[model samples]
Structure formats: C-alpha cells, structure tokens
Target chain A: MSSALRIAAVAALLSLAAAPAAQAHRAWLLPGSTVLSGAEPWVTVDGAISNTLFYADHQPMRLDGLKAIGPDGTEVPLQNASTGKYRSTFDVKLAQPGTYKIVTATDMTMASYKIGGETKRWRGAAADVATAIPKDATDVQVSRNVRRIETFVTSGAPSTGALKPTGKGLELEPITHPNDLVASEKGRFRLLLDGKPAAGVEVEVVLGGVRYRAKGPELKIMTGGDGVFEVAWPEAGMYWIEAGVRGAPNGSAPAQNAAYIATVEVLPD
Target chain B: MRILKFSGLALAASGAAASPTVGQAADLTVSVEIPKLNVAEYHRPYVALWIEKPDQTAVRTLAVWYDTKLKANEGATWLKDMRTWWRRAGRSLNLPADGVSGPTKAPGRHVVSFSGGQLAGLAPGDYALSVEAAREVGGREVLRVPFSWPPRGAKTATATGSTELGAVSVTVKP
Candidate 1:
C-alpha cells in the first residue's frame, strides 16, 4: 500500500481499539467527603469522565449543567467552580445541617434528516427542532437524550427533603439514605422513570478503585416489580451506580433515552 | 352511674401501677476502656456506645462522650470522627440529649449502667453493644460485644481493641 493508505489503515485500527474505551467512559461527581459534621462545613467535589472510577484521567465533565440543591430544597450556587483539563472542581459550603443534592443534568435532542439528496444532522434542545430543521426535509428521525449525574453530601444529620425526584427522566428514590450506607448491610433504593416506578430495569453497581484490581468488580442488579433494588456492599468505599432506559416512540413524540448515575460512599461497619 | 365511673377509674389506676413491676427487669451494664498512648499530644477520645439488633440497625444509643462544653457547641464538630456511630445513629440524634450525652472521659475503664426502666422499649432479642472511640491526632477503633436480651442468666461478653481503645465488656443480669 502507498504511504498515505498505510497511515489511513493504521489510523482505522487505532480508532477501532479506542472505540470501546470511549463507550465505557463513566461520568461521576466525587465529593471529598460525603458525610460531614460541624457548623458550615465545606466540601470539595471533582467531576470527570474517565475509564477509572473516581480518577480523573480523561475529559473534564462540564459544569454548565451542574446544580446544588440545599437542605431547604432551594438551589444553592457552587463556590470556586473551575474546569481543568481532566476534571472540574467545585466547593459547597453546607450552612444548613441537612443533606444536599448535587446534580448535573443534560438534555438534548439529536436529529438526522435528508435535505434534497444529502443527509444532515443537528443536536440541540427539543424546542429548537422547528427552526433548525427545514420544513421540506424528509425522513427526519429525532431522539431525546437525558443524562443525570448526581451525588449527596450531608452536613450533620442527613435529611430527605432534598431527595425528592423531579418526575422527569430516570431518578433514584432512596429507601436507604445514600450517605448512611454501611458495608455488609443491605442498601435499598427504588428507580423511577417519568414519575412512575421503573420496574425490571437493569442497574449496574461498581465500587471505585478499579485501577488496583485486575477485573472490574461490577455487580448487575435488576429492579423488582416495585422498582426497588437492594445492594449488599462487599466492602466500604465509593461506589458508582448507573441505570438507563429507552422509551418507545409514540405518535409524534420522539423516542427518549434517559440514564441516571450516582456516586455514593459506603463506610465499613 | 357515679359508683360505676368511680370503680372504673380505680381499676385503671391500679393497672397502671402494676405494669412496671410485672416481669423480671432487664438491666445492662457496659464497660468501655480508653487506652492511654505515649504520644506527645494526647486528647481524650470521643466515645459512643449504642445497641444494635442482629441486622445491625441501631436500636438505641446508650451514651456519647465528647467535648460538650465548647462554646456554641463547637465541639460537636468532631462528632463525625466517630464515623460508624455517627452514620448509624448519632447524626439523627439531637446533641445534648438528656442522659445520653456527656463530656469526654480520661483514659481508663468507665462503666455505665442502664436500668430496666431505661431499656423499657427494647424488644426481647439478640443484640450487640457497639463501642466506638475516636481521638484527636489519634486513631479510631470499634469493638462489639454480643449478648441476648432479658438475660437467661448472669451473662458477660467482652472484646478488646489494640489502639484507641482497650478491653470493652457488656454485662446483663436477670
């Protein structure tokens, strides 16, 4: 093969090797400490999309969609938020003595349509579809993407006031308080989709520190009929849980794909 | 009608008086030992004692020893250092709890006794007494002693910790 063709062939092989790793990149928000005591204790959190859990070696997770819900259910602003090359770091001053929910949710609409004899793609919010896609376009296919990444931090006592679900996308209704997890004890939670129980969904649970182990100790669990699932932690550390579901297209509405990811800390008994 | 009402009131009063002494009272005594270390800077460890069911759910908190006298209750700040108890029960408890919270103790064996009246609502079952201690600039340790409720007989269970805590024991008497 010619030099240019040989280079193209090698690039194709390299891209093939990198495809799976890119698809496996997990996004997480890791707090320095999940449970805290004291008056107005501050917690630092790092956001990243990386292959190794909790370790920021890949692309930084953007903070534009990040929000912190205070103990009072009010939106609290993140302090000293900065986005570095590999991660995003922010601080939260827990003035209230209850649990706070930090979340980053992104919603987008992906569309592919044929213009004359050519195909074009557009990605944006659902509201922009009318203007972004011409009326003459044919064979238009649209899909909605919703991703929610979250973690909890408690200052003093943990409370559930901030844990109420938004009735949109995939969310966790924690029967077992997230910050109160202990090793060897069962942690119970319910999954919800669009304000209703999301039953029979597959949930993935993996403890952090995957870099030290030869194999990723990932646990697969299915939500029961009532959408509740129990996880008996093998040991104490940070754990990442993810669940996703796809909705069938209905009438004129686009097919929806939603995913919920949470990072929880489990203490040794 | 007056006579019937009077008799009914009298019967209810007698029934209330008879309940406390109905059965054998269950008394529990826990002894916690805070080991003295040779470190240059030593601070009395904050300790917490609580009862948990076989499923590890905290039934009741027996005692919490910490620096309760700090101005503005600032000493409660480090209460999370006793992490296990804090997550299990302490976080939910209001500090300065009557009869349950006290000041930190010096290095030595401290024994606390709970009468049947204090343990009144605890159901009859197998339970464990968990003792956790954390010190400033020092380590933390937890020791659990298992025992059954409404003692079958005079029973004593003990556990030892290498650092931050010494020998801990729980005693139950019928």
Candidate 2:
C-alpha cells in the first residue's frame, strides 16, 4: 500500500509538470485590427511561439469570451469562432463604428524552417496570451485580409528639365472603403510623370510588410498628353509608393537603379 | 592511450597555429528608404542586411527592422519577406537582433559602409557581398557585389540597388 501511494504521488507530480503553466497561454488572445463591410470579417490571431515545446497549427484550441473595447472604454462583446490555423472569423455586427480592442487566447508552437540546411529554434511559451486590438486598423494588420491600390499612369518624352533630378514628376493616389480587404488586391500602385502622358511605367506599392508588383498597363488608366495618368486601388491599407523606369544607371542592375519616392497614408472612407 | 591523446593535442595546436586569421572585424554603416505613394501611404519598410559567402551561405547578420512602432508583432511576421537576407543569415539567429530595431526608412538617399578589421576571423579568399531590401507594401530587390581580400591591405568595393533604396552604397577599407 505504501509503495502504491508513493507511485501515485510521483504520477501526480508528473501530471502537474506536464500541465500547461500559468503563462503558457500568453500568446492566444487574438487581436483584430481590421474588419471590412459587405463580407464576413476574420479576426487575425498571431503571437510569438516557442518551437522548443509546442507545434504549429495545433488544433482543438478554442478562444472563449471575446469582447471589443471601444476608444471610449466601452466593452463590446464580439461573436467569433476559430476557422483553423491562426485565424478566427466573426460577423460584421461585432465591428463597432469606432476603434476597438480584442482579447482572446490560443495554444500554438513556434517552428523554424531550415535555411540552406541549418536548423534554428525559436524559444517561447506554448500557451496563449491575451492581446488587444487597436482601433485604427489597416488591411495588413488584419489577419488574412487584403487591401486595394489604384494608380493612373502617363508617359511622354521628357522636356528640357522634366524627368531630371528636379522636376514636376508624378502623383499616386490611394482609395479605401470602410469595408475589409481582400488578398489578391494587395501590391498594386500607379505612376504619372512629366507634362506628356507617361503610360505603363513600372510602379510598385508596398504596405503592411508585403510587396505587390504589377505593370502599369494592368492597373488600367488613360493618359492625357499632359502626362496625367490614373489606376484603380488594387489593395487598401497604409501604403508607400515608388515609381521609376526599370533601366537606369543608378545601380548596376536596371532593377537596382530604379528611383523611389516617399511613403503615403491611405485611410478607408 | 595516453600517447595517442598527446598526438591528437599536438596536431590540433599545430593546425591552430597554421590557420590564417582572415575574418576581420569590420563596422558597416546601414540605411533603408521606401518610395512614397499618394494612393495609400505605406508605413516605413522593415529591412535586413547581412554578409554571406559566394555560395550563398550566411556568415553574420548585420541588421533587422523589428519593433513595436508598426504594430503588435508585425515586425516578426515580415522577417521572412526579406528572403535573401533571411535565408543567408537571419534564419540562424536565436534571438531578435541586439543592435538594429525599428520601422523602415523614409524615402531618401542613404549610405552604409564596412571595413576589413571588422571582419577579424574570416579567411582570405574571393567573397561576394550581397545586400537585400524588402518593403512592407513595396517590392523586394537584392543587389550582389563581389569583393576579394588579399591576406593584407585594405580593399574597397561599392554596390548599388534599385526600388526601395534611393541608393545603397558600400565602402570597405582595410
């Protein structure tokens, strides 16, 4: 009987250690920074995970008691369900008219892939933690959401000082809706330079830590003789625009020599 | 057994003495710039730079743009976008970089340089230097520049890139 009790005590200790620790669930609370209208909104769930203990895409994990706190400090309950992986979706009703905060949790592991045949490890806890969602959300900030960017391009022979280091160059504009974003719509930008029409100049629009590249023609625009052009917004979010010719001497490679402008902010209407 | 152990130690010491110290410790000035847009302004880009060998093997991580200013953990998610630098150097890092942090650079001309003494332990050989930039909402471009170091003396090479960088110049001095 004494031996039996000893065995039971050891087993209990083992179970305690194996059980999830207090902060092990620190990464779970999902944060939804973006929500689009006219479609189901998916809240993004992400956090730093330790590959040493947990595994990726661990299912059977669920987040309960989700609520959004408005900028005025009002608690708004959100309806949600885990779709799979590191994502969750909710109906549009949960998104209030103002900025909000989201709190939830998930159990996932961090894993590292071999780069050039080396195995690296990411160290962190396995349990989910609660994270707040910011009110001012962008497409990139939302999990699995995409934004649209539109531009108008025009092309014409450079006049005396046009296209020179100092000249009246181009104008890129961004349009967004209060609605959410779509993935395929990301990475689209526009270009317009000189007084004559400069159509089809290669332009790139980058945002939310992702890059989307497309030719000016695909962006759709009609150029006037005055070098004024336009394209539709392919993605929505805060964005930075760059427009230039592919073949230039600024860098050894033509792609390397292309010049870039400045960053721009696009807010949804 | 003792005799064999002694022989092994002797060989190791001799090999160590004969090895040339070529990984010179060097300092590099780094900068990043993302083009501007009017449609939807993009946030600053998150850029990473590192040194690698000719075969595309990683030697060291020079910089990374990971921080809280952008969003909660957005910097960590985008680390993979800087593919060249990530594969060559970043994937091997055990922790966030110690010195480099923050969002992308504004649109402007920027410059970075390195020296020979900074590469204190490298071997003298033909080396290819590569710099890669990736913008959050912008495209990615990798610029490769080749340089060779003779055991002694300071050698320099300059390489430039397009897109996200107004200009990326590298100066190496012994």
Candidate 3:
C-alpha cells in the first residue's frame, strides 16, 4: 500500500475504536394527551431529535416554520421552541373538541466537503457514497439533514380531513385517518407530488429503532403507476415515515433531493 | 391494549359461534418458502405474516412463528430482528396468542391460512400481504405481495427475498 493508503487504513482503524456508539437519529413527538374530557382541551407537545425511545443527548434540531392545524380548518401558530438540556418543547392549544395536528418541518439540507484540493457538494444518491472520500482528502465534510415531525391530539369526536397535501414538497396523505389507526385495522395512504400521486419516490419507515429496507412487513416499496403504497402496521406507537424524491441533477454533482417525514401515532383499540 | 390486540381473534370466534356448520373455505392462502442456506450459524427463523391496507396499516395477522416453546418464551427476544413487522404490529401482540401464533418452521415451504371467522369484516380494497423473517446469528429479509382485497375472481402475487427467506406468495379467491 502507498503511504496515503496506509495512513487512510490507520485512520479507519482508529475511528473503529474511538467513534461513539452508532445510533439512529429520530424525531419524537410527545403529546400531553390523545383524548380529552370536555370543553377546550390543550396539549403540551415536547418535540426533540434524539436517539432511543426518549432522551435528548443529541444536537438540538431547528424545526422551521411550525404550525398547528385545528379541527376547524384554521391554522394556528404553535409557540415556544424552548431548547432544554436534553430536548426541546413546544405548546399548542386545541380550541375545539376535535383532532388537532401540530407539525414542524425543515428544508432539504446539502453540505459541501473540502477534500484534498477539490471541493465537492453532493445531494441525493451521491451523498450515500460521500464517505468514500479518502482521509488524505477528507479536509472538511459538512452535512445538513432535513426532518419533520407531526402529532395528532383529539378533544371530542375524533376528526379527519385535516391532513390534505398542500401541493408542495414530498408528502404522504393517509387514506386511513391518523386518529383512527388501530391494530388489525387498515392504514392506507397515497404519495403525492404537487397534490397528485408522487411518482418515483423512495420511502423508509423506522420501527422499533430499525428502519425498514426493500422488504419485510414495512417493505421498502415504490408507488406504482397510481402512486399508492401500503405497509403492514404490525405494532403501534409513533412510527416515523420517511419519504424522499430525487429530482434531475443540477449539472451532475447530484440530483436535488427532497424528503418528507411524519410521525403518526396509532392507539390501541 | 390487550382488548384491541385480541379483538381480531374474538371477531373470528364470534363468527364461528354464530354459524357452526357454515365452514367457509379459506379465501386467502399465504405460501412462504424458507431456503436452506450454508451459513456458519443456521438457526431457524422467526417469521411474521400479515395483510395491510394501502396506508400500510396491518389489517390482519395471519401467523407469527418465533421461539415459542422456550420456557419463558425467550425466543421472542429476537423477534425484534424482524424490524419492520415488530414495529408495525408485532410488539403489541401477546405471546402464545391462540390461533394467530405458532413456533418457527425449519427450512421448507409453510402455508398459513385465513377463513371466514379469521377474516371477518375485511372490506374490499387494495392491500398488501407481507412476510418477514429474522434468524439467530443470521440475516433478515422481508417480502411483500401487493394484491386487492375480496379477490374479484382469483388474484395472486409473489416476491422472492434476497436472504434469510425464499419465495413468498399470496393467493386469494376471485
């Protein structure tokens, strides 16, 4: 091996020994309650990006442009992005006795890397191989990850139709209402791009900390000509559905990619 | 949680109770083939099979085979390896569930059937029949056969997994 190759091998060995334990990044949506008693009921939501079932040891995430969709079809602004020692908290008030949705989203993030003398910025599929950059050339690598979180709270008769796609970004519209999800019940959804079925989309569902691949119960599948897909909802809690689309490359560096995420809660019937 | 977990079975049982002699032929049949592979550690796999809606909701669980014979159901500890299935519906199910649960099968083809009571109240719609397998010290794989509900005449779909499992097929009466 050449001197550069030897150095790179040594660095790989060192990283294997010194790197932190591998953990998947997850956005948790913790709502105060799913069902309310009477009159106006408000839910306190604690949202954070972290590892494990619940804990905030990771970096705080900036949930850009937060809003709450009330049952009455009015969009209310959520308040407080309080960054805690381990997590962040936000609050939303449900003025009516129906299901309310609190959502926050971030844009697609791309990072530029300076390796050796060449500067390279890759997005979409190219980012998957960015690690191939040799240590000698690994001067600096920057990464920005896009993420979104959503939670549903209900006050009285659980409502639906509040989650329609807004004709923007990669989104999933559940034919099966979020509030009505239960075990042994059908959970259906359609992938939409600009209000229609989103064509040629890739999806990743994280369950029990394990992300679904091309097969399995939550089989990684692409929408057919109809832009509809289904997953076998095995167990229930908060399931993070990650969807991404890669548009045409803007000059061969990498295709401009966009991602959509929603954490839907399924209650025990 | 327990009530909702067993309601599927309960619904089936009630349907059977209502008409003892109806004896509806199983409308759907799931065929899963396990390939014998040359691996260092070759323990049988714990597999989970179910049907889901277009939204990917698990509408019904046909069967789950894991380390059920262990004294304390210790084999279940590894069920999480089935990843996608565990998160979608496995974790909530009580072990040793009467008709919907069983023990893991050796390398071969296995069939799990669903009848009238078992499939009580399933509405006609687009659905996917999914199967996943995870083994001890072995790899994991998942297969999905997307098919419509209440088969118009006879409908079937099949998919082959790359590892752990072989060909998986779903068949429903037309």
Q: Please write out the lDDT profile of model 1 over residues A5-42, one tens digit for every residue.
A: 99899878755642312447899999999998877788
Ranking by DockQ: 1, 3, 2
- The chain B TM-scores of all candidates, as shown, are 0.86, 0.66, 0.85
Error of 1 at B28 (Å): 5.6
Candidate 1, B37: how far from true, in Å? Answer: 3.3
The order by descending lDDT is 1, 3, 2
lDDT of 2 by residue, B81-138 (tens): 5655654455445334334344455666555444332343445666666666666667
User: Can you list each candidate's DockQ?
Assistant: 0.52, 0.01, 0.02
lDDT of 2 by residue, A1-269 (tens): 69999989987875564333322321222233332211112344332222211122333223354444443455545454445564344431323223334333222233222444443323233221112222232221111101111111111100111111112334432222112223333323233343233466655444432323332212323434443333345454443344543322232211111233323333232
Runs of candidate 3 exceeding 4 Å displacement: A1-3, A6-23, A79-81, A108-147, A200-202, A208-221, A252-254, B1-174
lDDT of 3 by residue, A59-80 (tens): 5545556678888778966766
**Local error of candidate 3 at B150, Å?**
32
Report the candidate with higher lDDT, 1 versus 2.
1
Ranking by TM-score: 1, 3, 2
Error of 3 at B116 (Å): 37
TM-score of each: 0.81, 0.34, 0.47
iRMSD, all candidates: 1.4, 16.6, 15.0
